[model samples]
Target: MEFWLRVTRSQITKEIRAGRTDTWAAFALVVRLFREAMRKRAAGDERLWGDLLRYAQDVVDRTPGA
Candidate 1:
């Protein structure tokens, strides 16, 4: 979870730093990575998954043009 969060933050930061006007693609990458991780592992914790998704959504909502 921490790894995914860090990756998301890094991706978002990178996109913003590069002066990109759109960040949905970066967020999509994070979501895809998280989903892949969930598929490969047991990923039975619904609470953790919800928290991560909510966090991602909040970030997206706060970001401009995301």
Candidate 2:
């Protein structure tokens, strides 16, 4: 759990830095992250999975043409 959290944080930081100048790029990064997290959760890790899933849904709901 600690390792996953650390990896997620690092990936988010990198995504943010990479997409700083592009909103669409940021959204794409988040969608990709969400997918990866979902896959991980489905594999075994249940901790905080619901929260992450909800967040991903919210992002999709709010995004235009999603």
Each prediction's total of clashing residue pairs, residues at least 3 apart in sequence or on different chains, is: 0, 0
lDDT of each: 0.75, 0.74
Error of 2 at 9 (Å): 26
> Which pairs of residues collide in candidate 1?
none
Best candidate according to lDDT: 1
Q: Please state the error at residue 32 of candidate 2 in Å.
A: 1.2
Please give the lDDT score at residue 17 for candidate 2.
81
**Model 2: residue 12 alpha-carbon error in angstroms:** 20
Model 2 lDDT, residue 8, Cα: 63
Per-residue lDDT tens digits for candidate 1, residues 1-66, read 899688878978888889884787767876797786576456565665666778879999999885
**Model 1 spans with C-alpha error above 4 angstroms:** 1-43
Which digits, one per residue and each the tens of the lDDT, describe model 2 over residues 1-66?
Answer: 899668766776776789654655775786687787778788997655788868868998999784
Off by over 4 Å in 2: 1-21, 53-66
* Residue 45 accuracy (lDDT) in model 2: 76
Candidate 1, residue 63: how far the Cα is off, in Å? 0.5
Score candidate 1 by TM-score against the native.
Answer: 0.38
Weakest 10 consecutive residues of candidate 1 by summed lDDT:
39-48
